[model samples]
Target: MKGRSILLDHVGEREAAALMVDGKLEDLLIDDDSQPRPGAIFRAICDRPLKGQGGMMLRLPEGETAFLRQSKGLRPGQPMLVQVTGYTEAGKAVPVTDRVLFKSRYAIVTPGKPGVNVSRSIDDEEDRARISAIGHAVMEGIEHGLILRSSCAGADDDDIAEDIAAMADLASAVLNDLEGTEPEALTEGDGPHVLAWREWVSAAEVVTDEGCFEDHGVMDQIEALKSPFIDLGEGHMYVEATRALVAVDVNTGGDTSPAAALKANLAASRMLPRALRLRGLGGQLAVDFAPISKAHRKQVEQSLRASFRNDAIETSLVGWTTMGLFELQRKRERLPLAAILRGL
Candidate 1:
């Protein structure tokens, strides 16, 4: 509530910085220097690898390299291990491998725990193989993973062995500074806003809720809300949060055909515009559909305004309402993906 900004006054004791959404204030007020950051993380020089471009053309330390696109738990000649994960409105520094360290500590396991402990200060054998990789991410509940060195968050076991012998002596001086040629590190991380504040400063997630599938025409009571915890795929939908102000009715979740209501309204309008950029749903929002067949309402509002054409937000659709509602207006910026994974 009460946030959204974009001002830019004349020097000195600020004149504005207001731009709030969901609790409304917006219209963009930018007065500059709210502290700019988007760089830092060293080493990068090893280009040459674009033959058929599956990947490999690095040469960064200052300029090029940035190709790295191998999704679904990335991989390519192993030993990669990235972690930055954010910072690229143009200022680079956006790594993110080791499958985001096993999905950012995936709801930190606690089920009758027998394992899942991390302590360090350097002892050896790669700090006992990073504490046997956090005891195999607490008995393989690691649908994700990452363990480089963090001075052991809240140390104990002899202050995590003096921080795992100082990261096994900086991994033995990064293996004696890569012993003469061929290196491509950039591990300086923590930007995508301080790595979205250590992934939303923890402490939350108590309750939740469902989905299903069965080829073409479904409904065994909707294929019994398919599970692995909800994934109503036709295209995709995973909006874990936005808190409020996101109103998307788009019926056809009962479906028929304007084409299977523009394919379940184009798989939930591209999964509600990427669940409104990962559920950060800002102020005035609306997306009510499921009537469009008056000979296909302007071809489904021109295919939902060409699927909000690569939205940067600042949307508008005002076209149907004699009870066919299709009004639209999305304009929230910053902190979304469900309030930076709800650490807002």
Candidate 2:
């Protein structure tokens, strides 16, 4: 409860993983069996170009269609490898990209982008040099790009090299199967347990027992997320998801001090990333902070930026609107938690 803990368990029949920091739920991952998950590699056939949208539709296995935004050189009936980028909204084609990547815990192999680099987070020159040498050694003849993740810092040399080699091998095998005429699935995306192991690389206690979610209060936290309200001690925030966007409203609870508005706004900013992460909410987000003076807008913006800086999801702080609201655009990388657990 005091430190970080990784809980691997199940939510109903679905596999789930939870990351808890200081006894608070920091992140959540739950398997959704309804769609083609992000990171799935496929050999797709170009169907037709949406000239109006400047995109092409790809035919995947099981009669599913994917939408690729970059369709400049692609023609109908051409075969290409694509990766599912994110969840598809209802009645929309799955979003995909031709740039496929093979990712693991310690390394990521980027196909068509040839280079060997280490994570910048490894600030130590010696560590970076050592990791770089390992990567270059393993990928000497490989044309695919190699990126040594931050987890390689201070890691065993043998382990890092093995990881790099494994990912490189996977990329090579997948890239070589581009001659197929029909659409096919090359690999599935990482599941909840595997994702937790890959992304939550910092030192932490690992709990893999059955029903660990219940044992660690993760289920309760998830249940609370079903509601729109979130308590921030002195104030509260409401996070509700609409078909168009996520709406957040901040309010100072019975606090009439001069700085109460700013205080509540800052609190909302700090807790917003984690809240959205747990809920698996993305796309457009509009935050209506408690009415603060223009002088405090910059401070609130800084707070929001800092909070989302380290989040794994890509989020763009689109800045304040003409009205008194802040906006964000986030990648829809995962299915909504509420939708995933609706009847379970």
Candidate 3:
């Protein structure tokens, strides 16, 4: 696979990074860690006792109350390792977990769960078995469990093993250091742009524009993500995010031919994932492609799947809805791009 150039533009409160693929904004990343989001692991001190789900909360060292799982028995002043699992909205306590997840390029090393597992996205049985065997062999005596990523599909066994071993060392070091460290984040999982391009792109391919994000066309692209409609010359896509799911609608105005509709929908399908990543839209997503005949729907679906296949984030096509909407889901580990910008 060919690599894409990366541009980091730091202009406003939140810095934006654009992955330039084929001269287009393929992926967008924003630095908006003003508050914790999902997958953020923090070493927190419990300031109060946690009760049932009605109003259970734990005060962190930062003088903020975080949502505590009702089932866990926690007391005041108890130091605990908590990972944010989900955050529904801004200014609200996020759902958290005690399980600490350490992610690497090719695997996620999780403590307490010992064994090797393949990513569910890798559907090839042979590849899964091969990666699993390699994972288990490399992680045999380690206390942490390993999850082989899809990127490791065709990787050499030795390379995979080495990466796993390195992650194990990092995990052990992190766990050991948690004893005396102040309340702080330990590590961060790779986002789509970083995970997809960092290793593949050269130093020259990665460029940074400090305080010039708005000058180099990056601001325009970032602004596009905030709008509900994205014009694509031949067609336009409408993006709507509700509390429940992210919905996308593809429309081809003034063109009614089957081929024209297919072309427009295909373009929209390719653009949708990039928009989703740029906007940090995740959870359940439904894309309603322009009405196409049953014979051509499969082609559009395949194209959409292909578009998402290259994404660093794991995504799955869950078939079409009864109403002819294309259904899919993407992994949500951080605040949406829009939310991050909103925080700024």
Q: Top TM-score: which candidate number?
A: 2
Kindly indicate the candidate among 2 and 3 with the higher lDDT.
2
**lDDT per residue as tens, model 1, 1-344:** 22322222211232212222432322212122222222222233334444564554333433433444443333333233233333233344333222222212112222222344443544566555655554463345322222433343433444444333443344334433433233355344323322332333223221111111111112221122221122335322333322454556554554454466666555566545545543335455655555446776667677667767855455676676677766666654433322222221
Runs in model 1 with CA error above 4 Å? 1-43, 47-50, 54-271, 279-303, 306-310, 313-344
Best by lDDT: 2
lDDT of 3 by residue, 164-282 (tens): 88889878877775564346566554443454343333233666656445554667777777788888777888988888899988899788775778988889978877777777777
Q: Mind sharing the TM-score for model 1?
A: 0.26
Question: Whole-model lDDT, candidate 2?
Answer: 0.92
Worst 10 residues of 3 by lDDT: 195-204
**Local accuracy of candidate 2 as per-residue lDDT tens digits, 1-344:** 78999999999999989999998999999998788889999999999999889999999999989999978999999999999999967788999998898999999999888899889999999999999999999999989998889999889999998988999899989988999789999998899999998999999999999988887899889999999999998699999999999999999999999989999999999999999999999999999999988999999999999999989999999999989899999999988888998847
Name model 3 segments beyond 4 Å from true.
Answer: 1-3, 44-59, 63-80, 85-87, 115-142, 145-166, 177-204, 209-216, 294-296, 316-319
What Cα-based lDDT does every candidate model obtain?
A: 0.39, 0.92, 0.72
Candidate 3's TM-score: 0.69
